[model samples]
Target: MLFSLLQPALIMKISNIEDIPGHNIVEFYGIVQGSTIRAKHFGKDMLAGFKNIVGGELKGYTELLHESREEASKRMIQQATDLGANAVVNVRFSTSSVAQGAAEILAYGTAVKVVPHD
Candidate 1:
């Protein structure tokens, strides 16, 4: 109820971490988002980007990263919501190597309450 009211289900966008709240949002703990990418994928994207310089749309790779990030972010938010958080603030994102062929993407933010302006 609290979270559903604050973070409306309609505008369920998970993009920038800066758009979120802080760490002290609630007592509940949740991990809404999780992302994993492959280096070979990035490399392929880079190659595709290079080809775009002489051809057409270069949006493929960009879209790939964007979608992955969004998925991760959404998951994170969902996790927090599952824990009964109304909002998440002070979010931060980071990418790291998971293995020789893979990389991990993370989207994190604090879940908190946003009082309505009455």
Candidate 2:
């Protein structure tokens, strides 16, 4: 996996806010985004149907969304890295139903280079 190949220190920072707190953004590399569509398998779908009738949380769907979000974030980070960004700011996520059983997860942010405030 890409994450496995990347050292922790080499991974770009990400934030939902416009700034990186103690750091200053010195360059803007435009917006970067990543997205993925996911759906449950037939067995999980059947289980989800049963859970819906029971009026409870669908664990399978929850896990699927979680994994999708992770993937989307990873892709977004990769794009930022490709642009030579050290951090991403103003990050945001959006979700939309792509089909009856599938949904798309999107991650976006402004890629930037940052330096510690002097």
Q: Give the whole-model CA lDDT for all candidates, comma-separated.
A: 0.60, 0.90
User: Could you report the Cα RMSD, in angstroms, for every candidate shown?
Assistant: 6.5, 1.8
Point out the worst 10-residue segment of candidate 2 by lDDT: 2-11
Q: How would you encode candidate 1's per-residue C-alpha lDDT over 5-118 as one tens digit per residue?
A: 556444433324544332322243444555657454766667776886898765765566677777777677777667666666566788776776456778877555543333
Against the hidden reference, what TM-scores do the models get?
0.55, 0.92
Q: What is the lDDT of residue 112 in candidate 2?
A: 96
Over 4 Å off, model 2 = 1-4, 8-10
lDDT of 2 by residue, 20-70 (tens): 999999999999999999987899899988997889898888999999998
Model 1 ranges with Cα > 4 A deviation: 1-33, 38-58, 97-102
| Candidate 2, lDDT over the whole model | 0.90
